[model samples]
Target chain A: MRRNKKERQKQLKETIMENPFITDEELAEKFSVSVQTIRLDRLELSIPELRERIKNVAQQNFADQLRSLPIEEVIGEIIDIELDQQAISILDIKREHVFSRTHIARGHHLFAQANSLAVAVINDELALTAKANIRFIRQVKLGERVVAKAKVINKEDAKGRTIVKVKSYVHKELVFIGEFSMFRSNFTETGDKQ
Target chain B: MRRNKKERQKQLKETIMENPFITDEELAEKFSVSVQTIRLDRLELSIPELRERIKNVAQQNFADQLRSLPIEEVIGEIIDIELDQQAISILDIKREHVFSRTHIARGHHLFAQANSLAVAVINDELALTAKANIRFIRQVKLGERVVAKAKVINKEDAKGRTIVKVKSYVHKELVFIGEFSMFRSNFTETGDKQ
Candidate 1:
């Protein structure tokens, strides 16, 4: 059941694309190869290590033109966005994000991730939160990967407001949810008034 | 009217305590002295530069046992906190917090600052946000100082919920306001359930 070198390399590339944070040991186990073999395949494919891949993905997605806010302010890595339609972001809770005493991820970090994604999904020159209703369903821990998905549910053209719905999950279990009422200047006939 | 060196140095320390990010040039203008004199006074008082002072505040406030969340996740410098009573925090928006195309600060950063302060005010080991209602009153820009104050408005011991009201201002103008409903495990007498 061993694939050829060329086939293995192609599959390796695909796997990394699907999950940039996958470690070499995990890849080796999945591919039924030694760690050295996995490293060699990665080298042949010109794939960098896990950290580099993550950094590259963040830099590439965030360096360009964001309609509403900067990538650094998004609170997570925006893997995909379809301007005012749908968006997805991934937040990896680190040591700094958890309580030193309890080791649970702070609630605001989760909220920040979800709220920022909601704002980033809007297609506008200026987007501000008029109001937000949010709920935290579960306590997230350190080193967990939280994926937040945002969708524009309603757009009020006359009022110049857009409603965004955001839900965050850790391992497919809901951790947080938010509904954001956003005011976008671009949607208003008045030119750039706060 | 230029004051004596002793009087000027004493006032300099108070000014820095009131606003930690005040530049030496501004201090000089206020004190009717040169920037060099301000630097000398700072050296005499053993006060570090503005950058170092900000760093020290962050490190000092975050390194201790925070009642609710970690210091690094708070999104601002917690200058003062009295458990379950009130708290004050400072957030300085920088280049990383604003859009590359626009200089306005992202809305979530402000939200994060306010929400975290709300959680940190609770005097409990485990405090979770059950719900929140928030409004962004105005847009914040880069290099602005956001000061957030959180006050405990309600505590229902039977319901095991506490309500905190947070108001954030940039130069005394309200920028954001939020009301957070927090659930604390200690209030329930259940002995730490998730």
Candidate 2:
């Protein structure tokens, strides 16, 4: 594994490309080089740091991630996401989100935030909510911020639907929860479900 | 199985109270009486006809039914319902229901109609959505009316939750669908779910 600089740098670029999450220390250990040497080689290869790489994986269309709709289509600000795995987002409840008389956040606003997050977490060209089961644990008041988390239950089921579970919280208290069955364009059906 | 007039009238009222959807002919056959006699007995008992009885079962709290909430709490005008069974309602898409830019009906409005209908169909003093799965098949337009139907899937599960399914339609085309798990006040939890 002790190759010259040119060969090591070439392999280093390929390694980082294959696994963007590999840290500098791990890369150094893999190549039997110092962490500083690995860092220098990464700079020459124009590879970003691990944190940036993870962010890029979620934000950019690189590595076939984020192939769904544009981020603007998502209702809230997505702070963290890993395609086909999990994602988190935040939404500020405003006047537009509440009932005029009750001042309670509408259930569907919470649903849309969760639905769009589920769609965003799928690494496919098209992600649509075929079915969803959701509940409001408590009334969300106006001016409160709702934080939503989405986790993919199954990458693809036998019926060619991706299952995602979402939970929405206001101030760490559970306010809403939902399970979404997503239909992705990439999966082919076994010819039973419609 | 013939009875006196007073006894027949008493049993007729009890039968209608137990099952509001029962028809006059069915009641006559059950009592071994003529349809005319059944009608006379119902009249004497001040019990309304089958149609009115079904409506009263949904609207009034005469028989431990319609206890979840008042009819005013339901989002749309309820056309038909049988507690812990099935229900139907219609929501006219007005100016307030649509998004200004797209002129498309907001998804939450449809969900609210469905959610409230689901809550209405539960035969309990309190019904809260513990979870729901929903999907929007097509976007509703500004002027289109949405018809939502709710059906109780399970009267009570082992976890003491009632499963309700709802589907919304626009001009006979499916627009939205949802399956909700409702927590009811009357059904005591067997002590597992939260």
Candidate 3:
């Protein structure tokens, strides 16, 4: 059954919220409406385009949570983060990230996504990688969306070291795994150094 | 002492070859000429802008040497490489690579440069990372030029694994180091699968 314009607009907003990267064509097909209608509905809802939406989500969700580094420096878009606990990030491989002839995504990009997430999860003024052990399980192709999950495994306040494990998946299949030992500077209360 | 136009143009080409990312303003200062004169010299030499020159150098030097992947996939500009022996690359940390508020270069960018250099040094039809041990010795700042050198330390042909060590430096100061264990696929002659 087709939804009325009023109902469809409400559902359109929900759909975009669910998947920010969905295109106008896909939304029109799903809603059984003209592409023009979808565009008009988006304009009325004050929703930006896909790229802007991605940037906004990244900036709004995880920017302030970062203490050691700025949010813009993260290699991927962070969707969720719990300081000193866990974090999740998404990376979409584009043409520039892939080998020109083979269209295979470079392994370093996957490493970057995982490594940055591990650093971003720290709750300190400075987080640096002391050591990392990593593996690439499979080759990723262009246009693939990689979801990386990073968890804090251990923290040693006396030594000022934290251990984080990161795993990257493409369509639920693991592509890379890494364990990072991070070094953080000592900080005291009142925002002063120890 | 400033050379004449012809001599300066020839020296300009050589200078760019030595430092692919030299800016027009810097070139003008180095050659004791106006920026406009430097631009004209580049035009006569059929040289593109700084960005294009970097891209061209990356493409022209390493494109054909790659056996496992395309050169464009490398994180930095590969200036020298000897398959399974050694390789060197340069990465310039620009504004986009740094934290917006702090101007500190992201750690993952440094890791990407080192990790990709390790992968590019392997001589095989396919190279994948089995494991990597890495360390960030210090924080890198924006606009720093990082030179990463990768050397193959060991190879276990029977196990299909090669160990490579990469060290990255900014102005001769060590910033990052990594040891990578890479897996190579078995391939037969005549470009046939094993």
Candidate 4:
């Protein structure tokens, strides 16, 4: 019975990894174990109860993508947070930071820096971007320091939706502006996920 | 004259990164260097000449934002590419590969897997996403092997635009479907960049 339980736990871990959203009842029925046992197994595996798993999945994906790229020209760090609503961070797009390219860092870099700061500030683990609309109002020449500010415009937990507004500037001149809508979910539920 | 020249080159590199879309002659004038020196600098930096830089700078922004997260799980690998139309990759989402508050891998993982494949298939370095619409059709449960596929639907070089369709499947059953619009720019006459 002990060996059989260990094997069952291993299988359960595999199942949860493949699809972190499977419920306790589902696991119990599939593995012929009580729901309580399955919960215990989850705890043993160090998997975040349920909410942590969902959020970790999203954060992990972002980290994985970043690892695949080659970047050498970033001068910013996230400094603040506001849970699920919004975040703010500051960046110093230095003049001599040779960006592996010949031109100025495009507007997207600024937008991306601000967006990542916002993502980090969101307290949840599972947040996916639904929409991002941005406008480039001014040019951000080299050596000009910039500040990025992001704020959540709307959040509906029941509906699993959130929106954010991000703006970047250099010495009071708007350089980049954007609005993003993120899809949030807890492993216990999955629906209308677009 | 030697020190002045070196200082001018450093300034030019910064200016170029800030305005990757500028003409070589314009950049030369801005930094008091010959266009030839700018060309040489671009080559040293492994970047394209001029026109390409402009196009590249416009599109490669938000992608940088998503890549700021840290790596904890990698469930997919891109396999092949077929021009400006379609990209194909394979993914193995396992139970142990999960992260965050949610147990299930976030939707962005699947999206990033598909998006990265599309970017890889592009001939240029900078591929900017204009729009991406996705639908979760079925539950991608744990231990279920899956595959992701992306196909470009449209390409418009003059406006720097490309549209692609993405789909994920398990055992031949569709699990997710998506549409992505990405913009491409060469960044200069030198090379394709992301």
Q: What order do you get sorting by TM-score, best first?
A: 3, 1, 2, 4
Find the 10 residues in a row with the least total lDDT in model 2 chain A. A58-67
lDDT to native, each model:
0.83, 0.80, 0.82, 0.59
List of chain A TM-scores, every candidate: 0.68, 0.66, 0.69, 0.52
DockQ per candidate = 0.37, 0.24, 0.35, 0.03
lDDT of 4 at B18: 83
| Tens digit per residue, CA lDDT, model 2, A85-164 | 99899999999776555576766688879887988899887666667767777878899999999999898887888999
For candidate 2, the docking band is acceptable
Cα TM-score per model = 0.67, 0.50, 0.68, 0.43
Give DockQ: model 3: 0.35
Q: Report the lDDT of model 1 for residue B127.
A: 78
lDDT tens readout by residue for model 4, B36-84:
8878877776768776665454324323322311111112654444556
Ranking by lDDT: 1, 3, 2, 4
Clashing pairs in 2: A132-B133, A132-B134, A133-B132, A133-B133, A134-B131, A134-B132, A134-B133
- How close to the true structure is residue A159 of candidate 4, measured as C-alpha lDDT? 54
lDDT of 3 by residue, B82-194 (tens): 99899999999999777676677777788778877887888776776767888877778888999999999886644557889999999998888898877777522222112
**Residue-by-residue lDDT tens digits, candidate 1, A85-177:** 988999999987777777787777887788788878887767777789898877888899999999999977446778999999999998888
Q: Least lDDT summed over 10 consecutive residues: which range in candidate 3 chain A?
A: A185-194
Query: What's the CA error at residue B124 for candidate 1, in Å?
Result: 2.4
Compute the DockQ of candidate 4: 0.03
What level of docking quality does candidate 1 show? acceptable
